[model samples]
Target: MQWYLCALTALLLATGCKKTTCECPPKTDDPKMEYTELNDKAVGFNSSYSLDLNKDGEADFSFSTLLVGDPVLRRDYRQYYIVSKFYTNCLVNGNEETPVLQKGDKIGSLPPEGFHWYNASHVVIAQKIIEENGTSWSGNWKQVAHAYQPVSILKGDKTYYGWIELSFDMQSEKIILHRAAVAKDPNVEVKAGG
Candidate 1:
């Protein structure tokens, strides 16, 4: 068709006059950000990792691990908790479990199909239940490396989306946090570590 010639001509022109910036996604983001490098932290057995999600110098969420025993039920529970001091939410599939997202994956306020933004102050993740019969796990974070957790922070009148990179030590039920980042714009999707 005659349209093919026009398309070819347009493509040639675009190639001939290439701009300084390419139209493809960048390999890495150089965010003009305050929280560029995250502090290395771990929480286990009553100690908590207090987080300042927006890098505003105020603690927004506190993460801790707890071990509980129920003598009557002959079971023990090791749980990870995220307690928010402000309005904060995390991604979950409604099974009390947050998925382990990889690098470059999108972190958004609205989750895909089965997942949802967990709208609560206290969220229990990576729950490990031990019983005489066997041991079972919940919340996914066990043994994962460089994993990302999708998060949302609602401060004042706006909601900011972000992500936190984490790793879990199942032996000690410790949660190791490596990095955290927030999108420059409110309510926009951010790459896991960008």
Candidate 2:
């Protein structure tokens, strides 16, 4: 009985001392994802691009810019003018709408009441040219107007943050997207002027 008891105790000790492997998998660093700089020209009066900031198969962000037009003139006189607008994939529609202002709306200005209920999910950030002809416009030139302000966008259940800077050169007939920053997830916040 003494021998059996000693053997049982040894077996229990050996079993307890055995190395156990953890079931959890090893953690790896996430892929290095960063914003991409884009320099594109507007097809007509507008240009759009779908961005996948996280390298995910699906597009996470979309940006569109339209030249603001005068309601009275019914046209955009400034060839280089652009108002950068950011949107999620959900808000974009296949149908076309007039880019100019309608009744009760102001020219070269967003709706005073803010985005309509249908467009509540969309966010707008304006960038005007700060300098022109090697001198500050003194708020005169709308072509280069730009404000590097951060705007929050709510799409579906997630909220994203980003900033955009738009510059157009009439001489070159090009619209330059100087900076764009979009968050991959709601928890992560993007800095301004990205």
Candidate 3:
């Protein structure tokens, strides 16, 4: 009886101490709304625009694309990078005049209250440039540069957290964004779809 009691206590303790793990469902798109695609016409040197990513007819974020020349080369040629800015008002229109970053402008400073920029080192997503007959395509979702990272967007009073991926095609001059809304509180249960 003594041995049986000891065995039962050990089994109970083992079972009680087992850790419970939560499995989150994979991200899926909402069939009702389509993903936004910005083509070459919409992007250019010093071009800026407000994007309605979730298709709610409201601009959730804004972006500025800049073309900078190589310092050492000092040629007329330039490379492109994007600066992303968040908006508190969903209906905020883009600034009339798009601002361009100069060669000496600071590129690594923390973004202002509502803005963030991506440079060579800290790209938000993997980028692929597909070319066909001298035309470029930058909206491929299959090619992910790096694993998804957590990002939070504050709209009004609530802050939404999620994973985001961005892709740009240099030749085609397009930007593709993929986002999945996660739980507001990371520790809480995450719903299946964003």
Candidate 4:
């Protein structure tokens, strides 16, 4: 009786067993590039606009790419080393050194009402039309460049989570930059300059 009971249990267990398989996505060998710093070191600024000081519905920075960098996203793309701007009063230390703007550097105070564009310790007003006759591209998104305010230091991690958006408009011939609210670990700052 005992032997029969043991044999029956063994048979039932064998029939009820099912093979387990693991499904894992394939890992690519491609490297993940780190973001570079955007201080005076790894960045460059160049202004091409001619001033239309009268503001007759015209821009001052005109007819050229103000600043270009390695495409913002790529598997091999490295982080920016320094925050560089092509517009005047964009760089903190006049673009003379690397990492011109450091962490904890107090940017200027916000304006009383509308858009308050600024840099560290600078209340930036538009000096020239960075681009009057701007470039045009097609699609739902277009690219154009114009001078409005100076510029400010923006963290890189702030970019991925939709903190900053850079787009262009072909129909309007304008490059649009929108700054969004940031919520991230302050310790994970990207030092730009590479």
For all predicted structures, in order, the TM-scores are: 0.74, 0.37, 0.34, 0.24
The Cα local distance difference test for each model comes to 0.74, 0.40, 0.36, 0.28
lDDT per residue, candidate 2, 111-152, as tens digits?
223322123223332223322233222111234534342333
Off by over 4 Å in 3: 1-46, 52-60, 70-72, 76-79, 86-150, 155-158, 178-194
Best by lDDT: 1
Q: Show pairs that collide, candidate 3.
A: 126-145
Greater lDDT among 2 and 4 belongs to: 2
Model 4 regions more than 4 Å off: 1-163, 174-183, 190-194
Q: What RMSD does each model have against the real structure?
A: 8.7, 13.5, 12.7, 17.2
Candidate 1 local accuracy as lDDT? Answer: 0.74
Q: Which ten residues in a row have the lowest lDDT in candidate 1?
A: 29-38
Per-residue accuracy of model 1 over 26-113 as CA lDDT, tens digit each: 5765433324355558788678877786777877667887888999999999888776554787766756666678887877755766
Candidate with more favorable, higher lDDT: 1 or 2: 1
Cα lDDT of model 3 overall? 0.36
Q: Pick the candidate with the highest TM-score.
A: 1
Candidate 3 weakest ten by summed lDDT:
89-98
